[model samples]
Target: MPTREDPLVSFKFGLEIEGKLTGFFTQVSGIGSESEVIQHKVVNSETGETIMQQIPGRLTWTPVTLKRGVTSSMDIWEWRQQVVEGKIGEARTNCSIVAYAQDNTEIARWNFENAWPSKVVGPEMDAGSTNYMIEDVTIVHEGVERVS
Candidate 1:
């Protein structure tokens, strides 16, 4: 049987960027009070392209809706690599876990600059659910990256 003590699902993802680190963003969504999904996307400003994006994977552990005031530490690391189309690539490593409050009424927002391969711990929410396919997501870069 499953218990509340266990998170409903847990998994790690990676994002590949091209060029120097420009900025990154995270949007965490919860089911009720436990952390459900910790999603993030990063952008490279120098070349105006997304350095990294989430690569979907399987969720093994039980999923928990994130709660407010709970802080999960994420160990973020980045590395530069090469890809197709002659585009510079960046690899992002996501580690650790954190929780953000969903009861906050303040405007949700976060900003980063020249911070590549960095881990961000904060509270940000929009909309989320676990019953069905929750589209809760965080878009870091709206641009595109092409490497040869």
Candidate 2:
């Protein structure tokens, strides 16, 4: 028999984009993939009953959103700018979301293929409030797979 263990915590993870360290991110969401289904009807000859059968259809990966406090680097913004300028092909790259253990060792990794920045949002400024400036970016990818 196998021994049971507790699942990994969510916060101890990291993000890497095209082999570049993305630094610390406050939030990472929308890491999902889904497939559509096609349905068909089948009829029973003797009982005169109908049944619906489903078949797998197209697959789609949801856009991933990454949020973090403002930094001096403009790498995320530069990637988005390329998209806005109709240079999508040059902007597409691979990304990895890695899970780290308590000892800071990489235990698992999810690799996203052909990813590109779809949108970028800047931090909001308020004169009366004091908070860390946060920026967010949305990334679209063709597929996502667990590599480890």
Candidate 3:
């Protein structure tokens, strides 16, 4: 049994698109967000001293990218097509990235709200090299939270 203090392995993570495991992804990245900092200058009335202060402005969420071995499924591509056709709002869906323990027990999960595919990259072809055909999709989301 793994304790809470134990660090979860990165390779044991799972991805769920709209609450369903569509397929196994080889890589998942960009689970982060940042806020724009605004600097404010304050002047003292009595001493006439000026100081700069930093304040939080707008919050921006980084697009999450997922890479998986190419399969016969056209689900990811279909989602991207919707975006290209100006159906972005209707294409928005929730997604989850989950990390599991060695025993396959769910440990931690990050849920993303109103996510849609912003970009999709197909596998590069090479005649001399052998590699798994990988397809990647970048998902832009409005908000993300650690649900478990």
lDDT of 2 at 111: 94
Worst 10-residue stretch by lDDT in candidate 2?
6-15
- When 1 and 3 are scored with TM-score, the better candidate is 3
Count clashing residue pairs per candidate: 30, 0, 0
Candidate 2 Cα errors over 4 Å, as ranges:
none
Error of 1 at 71 (Å): 17
Cα displacement (angstroms), candidate 1, residue 96, comes to 2.7
All candidates' lDDT scores?
Answer: 0.28, 0.86, 0.88
Shift in Å, residue 35, candidate 3: 0.8
Best by TM-score: 2
Top candidate when judged by lDDT against the true structure: 3
Cα lDDT of model 3 by residue, 39-146, tens digit:
999998999999898999999999989898899989889889999999988789998888777787888899999999999999998888789888999989999999
Candidate 2 Cα deviation (angstroms), residue 18: 2.4
TM-score of each predicted structure versus truth: 0.15, 0.89, 0.88
